[model samples]
Target: MNTITRLFDFPYHQLEKYNLSDSLVTKYGNDWIKTSTEEYLDKANAISRSLVRLGVNKDDKIALISSSNRTEWHICDIGILQTGAQNVPIYPTITSEDYEYILNHSESIYCFISDSEVFEKINAIRKNVPTLKEIYSFNEVEGCKNWKELLTLGEDKDNQNIVEERKNSIATTDLATIIYTSGTTGRPKGVMLTHQNIVSDVLMSAVRVPLRAGDTRALSFLPICHIFERMLIYLYQYYGISIYFAESIEKISDNLKEVHPHVMSVVPRLLEKVYDKIYAKGDALTGIKKKLFFWALALGMDYKPYGENGAWYEFKLKIARKLIFSKWQEGLGGELELLVCGSAALQTRLSKVFCAANIPVMEGYGLTETSPVISVNDMRNGGFRVGSVGKVIDGVKVKIAEDGEILCQGPNVMIGYYKDETQTNDVIKDGYFHTGDIGEIDQDGFLKITDRKKEMFKTSGGKYIAPQVLENTFKQSRFIDQIMVIGDGEKMPAAFIQPNFDFLKEWGSRKKIAIGSTNKEIVSNEKVISRIQEEVDASNANFGNWEKIKRFELTPDIWSIEAGHLTPTMKLKRKIIKEIYKDLYHKIYS
Candidate 1:
């Protein structure tokens, strides 16, 4: 087979070549379930054959709705692909409206769900979807067909020939998946990616971040439905690496300790939480221990990735590594060699600190339209940049537009937004996909993101303010949890702040301050407001007077996915936040 064809069909080839036993590990309740490569392939093949029997044709769309990461997710994904069908993955946390929109838009024929809860979710709106033919559940349900029954449907000898013919018929340019982008603005767009788009990315990324089969153990916690984690799964399979699915978001710490994985993928939000937990522990320490903890953290924060510090600084860092950061390593399973952070910009301070503590955080940049990875930090390639998203990967060409928007041209770019020619034309023009993000390419070829072109807003004084810049800066403060900087057509930049409640309560206790019973009372307290003001002032010191936040309102409520304030990826939904806090915004400016 040609290189492109081989790349497109590598997953199935790997399954056929690898041994049958003990290849994949999945977490089930308190136990780990091990499945051999052959076993996995058999199940996936059976599902593919069954799908064919159900009249699923090439280019047919299949929707999968699941919450937890399990072996069945991978099995069904591969199965769908084997039948030359496209997979439409939906986040389990998405709204019912989203479910209806995606199912109808994609014109999915078969729906596979994880459990009864997900089944019920689909069942509620099943009548609305005209194209959907059958519903299958990974777990046994009252009304849905069990996934295991698909194997029986494919038990006939003729099914094997059908499977081989289906696999052979698939071309590298054929549409592999129709991933709906969870856009922050307007309706979600379905990004259509071909086999070549994803396969090229998988291969290119593998070169940057090398992994060995049987040697590297990966702990998967990020949503598999998301392209970032989904792409990593294919990369892991390509190298024959063993993957352990994390039980849930809450169990990540415990799972890390148990798995002792060499590498893992994460979003910036998770890293922020981890840092908070670490700082909390340090704050809990007393006397000399507390002093040392703060000292080490300060040293970490000031660390530079590329430049050299003096011998004295290096000596102290060694001591900190041995004394303070060693325990941090242990808490993370003690074997974490690399952490691939994407989905959002990681704070430069956090990245530096973690690296100084001997944990390398490799930050990358991409959107759903680019088959996800356009650039990433490669430790072996001198591509590590502290504040920048590393050098653009091989086979991808990145250039800055006159307005500073990053434009990319590569094989990895999606064909088009599914059935939306106008939208497709808006982004992909002259073979370059406009990334909407304003960024600059440094002398070293590293990409430094400044702000989003669409997100920058001007105040009444005509001074433009980038809310993300201020929000990122303010979040560095231990007192702040989540913040949104708002000032479009206003006098000065103002903010709606969510204080780190746990940290605030601890501070209140230490100071013997009386925090009232209600959330509103606590947030509106003079002491609480004063403390948050100090934090805002500290963050504002780095900016100009016009850019500084003049006034702010404290919100006791946390922004979350269910509450519609955050996207599934944990990015703040600015429009939603504005609408929800319309009165609060007026109050801040008033």
Candidate 2:
């Protein structure tokens, strides 16, 4: 196999060549409904041919703005690529303002929207976006050339040459996709990744945990707009893996059980929520079940670190898995080989607990600028490390800078943020792409991320505090679901916490507090705040005095994507949180 391929080159060709899809029929059956490989190639060729008919040429930007649906998304994406045009994907959840900004900023001439909602959204702002020349819809909507209709126009004999010529025009270093990340900072900046960047990442990641012909079921729910999931999509195809598109975020668990996937790429917040759900269920268990649940977790947490081959605590874990955690496994469909987590730092305790439960949760690290994956814990091949994001994959080089910021140099690193030369220069220096995160490599070469260099804050007492470390400690409390540590130039460290309402609501009922109170009133209650204060104080004991959270305020609402406190990838935008709840922090210190 060639070690590298151009983005415009057909990746699905490799799948067919390898004959790995033969067993896919047996594994997925009719549920694996995708635009078949032949159809995909035909559709892609047709679309590329049509784009040529429309006078689209190499390097012309084509934007795909839609939700993650299997067929239309691929048709447009492959179409755009096969035409030698750069594909820009926008999350359907983005606002009208952001949509307009990306359309004009990328200077996209051709755009494919999913449904009428997207059509209406763009149409409402189209008059203002001069760069947008045409709008195509996936479904037949009023006043638009449907996607299939556009492809039909390219049936001329000469169109095949257009597809071939377009493919040949693409180079490995040419821009493949421009993913816009609305990071914690101001407006979103376009992260430009080339064909070599992501394809290399996908192949390299496969080395750490080889994707075999039999081991190939995946539940695709994470937004392909994000690099982590996007890279996996190509990697799955590269490995001839059969992917099952999840219906939506709401149906992931059901989809997981139905797909019974061998592997999944997830974010830490999802894992944390799953752990909380299991813990909540355990809390409901009676007598023996309840005793067994805590006992297993305690054993996992207290057990000495065992390398991959060692099973010092396996005897206790085996009993625990059989008696208590087996039902939990059943809930996840029992066929999960590994769960990979990244996009944010996972609490070490939570990682420790899940791995102990025999559900191997391999935590990793990366940023959007780095083609989104720098390091991930090796699933079962290399000896696993509990607290780190495993070893760097082959072909990727990582080094800690003087101040602990992770610097990366690899084929996977983005070509730099699109069109923002000044800002791009600030981040990508020399050959290394500076990931604004801070971390240190352990003696074993596993990367343990401490905090974001940009997010680390100082208190008025002249003490530097890494809020992520403190926040991770607080997540262990089980009562505090999400917290934003804010002590930047303040007298002492204080925090705005979003309590686990499910846990609190249950606690409230047991204590006979009013059941129907608003979340704000519930969290603000003297008793509830005092209880959480004890949790903070307990968490503080584990950290150095300067790093401890001294005082905190609880918020009624959870920090979420819709709430704007968290990014879509589940990373907390601390500045946004602090700005949103400035009064709460002020009141706490006052």
Candidate 3:
């Protein structure tokens, strides 16, 4: 509403408003080459025009299946908007079953696939989707329309006007995108977010983080298909921040070195893995270097920020930053100012560890329903607090129900689940969206999320247990990679652990135990079992009796996308695991 409505109407059009001439670079090998934002926009416009030429009209749905990238993928996203069509992005790693369901369910008229490999999968199942009309592959493939060729169709002036007509007709309340939730429990439901929902988020997030023009730059990697990443795309554009797309997750370290981006957003799983990598590397250091690393880590824990009246702690923290944290900074390409984390609860220890390292890791909390952000720690305003998702963002009203469920009412909240009116009314009651998250507010107004209402379970002893809280605590232990606390409608909670097998394998070799063995053999070994048990026991001490994990079992293979144990977002599919491993649970309890 700032009166700058001419260049583009959609959220993706925000790119044209700011630094259209600035460098928008994507990674290639070790090089960071610049491509003008205008050039990127022109390509997008061409695609948009082409879609119009293909007879795509307002309110049409276009499916986008791809991974995180900087260049062409972004163009396709913008093109979807320019045509006044809804973008339905599916994860590149999505299962064939889900892919078929999403395509057929959404009635997508067209789809843009990332590469030939992805195109092949869709082509195999394309016949199943009766509504799908055209297929465009980002990378060239046989028998498919190339992405560049599609752009040529829009080059005609008449085609361009059709796209413009569609854009002019779009209302603020019109659906901008349909993001299907990759739920850990059930079939994925498409969440309909409007232009208003995302626009509100862009403004509110800026209020909390202050991504001022020319001051902030973001390195995008988290799948833009998810609300958490998608919302930030709008935020970055609205504030005129430079947006750089990372080449891949593997190249983040290198990309950070090159871009030195001030801000980035990620989930807890990625952060934990990065922290683990740093720890693993730190273990290789010897003598003073190793001792210094631990000393710096401890120093970070003790360092208190300014305005907290901890003068003594602040002074000590400064010395620690100089001595121990400086090297840690160097490893991260040295210029990270703030990291906004969401999707799952970040381990408090991880947040503190990064903060101690002089990089402010601000943890935030929200679901896809609330445009994915309601609260986040404000680094500039308040000292980042551990175990809290900061204060709620401005313009968002939060109230805790008598049952302790968190309810949020704001423009940022989604309109409702697409095509599911029953669910829509059931969750959004009396102008408030029931977040289904339990939380409490402190005197300082920082929100501490306690548990998920749906994920909580009761033990056979009639004691209530919240698995998420316990899982966060358990993850603090480096030995445990991922855990699912299960004892639902049972006597007591137990866990199915996916151990840090690499760490265990290394330990076995070091101790001269049977090293070259299968995962089952290694896990069953007395030494490995004892080591895992010690960590589990330590975690259990903080939990109430029935909530404590008892008699855990370990699986050798890593639970991964290929195995379907985890979603593309890396969240465990609990019900799937429960069904697959029912025998394992029965064996432990019976």
Roughly what TM-score does model 3 have, to 2 decimal places? 0.94
Which residues of candidate 3, in runs, are more than 4 Å off?
Answer: 4-17, 20-23, 28-33, 183-185, 307-309
| Candidate 2 lDDT tens digits, 1-590 | 45448653434545455444321221122365544556666667788788889999888899887665455676668778877789998887777888889988899998988778888888988998998999988766898768777777877658687678778778888888899987445678999988888777777787775456534677777887788887777767666666677767787787778778877778888888888888888888899878888898787675434543357567777787788767777778777767778888887777777776677787777777777678888656555777788888778899999999989998888888887888898988988888888999888788888888888887888888898888888888878989888878888888899998888888889888764478978876888878888898898999887777878888878787877887778878777788889899779888
> What TM-score, to 2 decimals, does candidate 2 have?
0.93
- Candidate 2 regions exceeding 4 Å error are 1-3, 8-10, 18-32, 140-145, 155-157, 183-185, 303-312
List the candidates ranked by lDDT, beginning with the highest.
1, 3, 2
TM-score of each: 0.97, 0.93, 0.94
Top-down TM-score ranking: 1, 3, 2
Per-residue error at 590 for model 1, in Å?
4.1
Choose 1 or 3, whichever is better by lDDT: 1
Candidate 1's residue-wise lDDT over 1-590, tens digit each?
22535233555555655553555688776788888778787788888888888888988999988888788888888889988899999888877788989999999988989999888889999999999998989888998998888878876657778878988889988899998976545778999988889888888888888566656788988888888888888888777777888888898999999999988998888999999999999989999999999999999988975547888888999999999999999999999888998988889998999999998999999988888999998767577878888989999999999989999999899999888999899999998999999999988899988888888899999998988888999999988999999888888889999888888888888899987767778898998999889999999999999999999998878788779888777888888899999899988877
- What clash count goes with each model? 0, 0, 0
lDDT of 3 by residue, 47-139 (tens): 888888788877789998876565676678778887778888888877677888888878899998877888888988988999999888877
Best by TM-score: 1
User: Per-candidate RMSD vs. true structure?
Assistant: 1.8, 2.8, 2.3
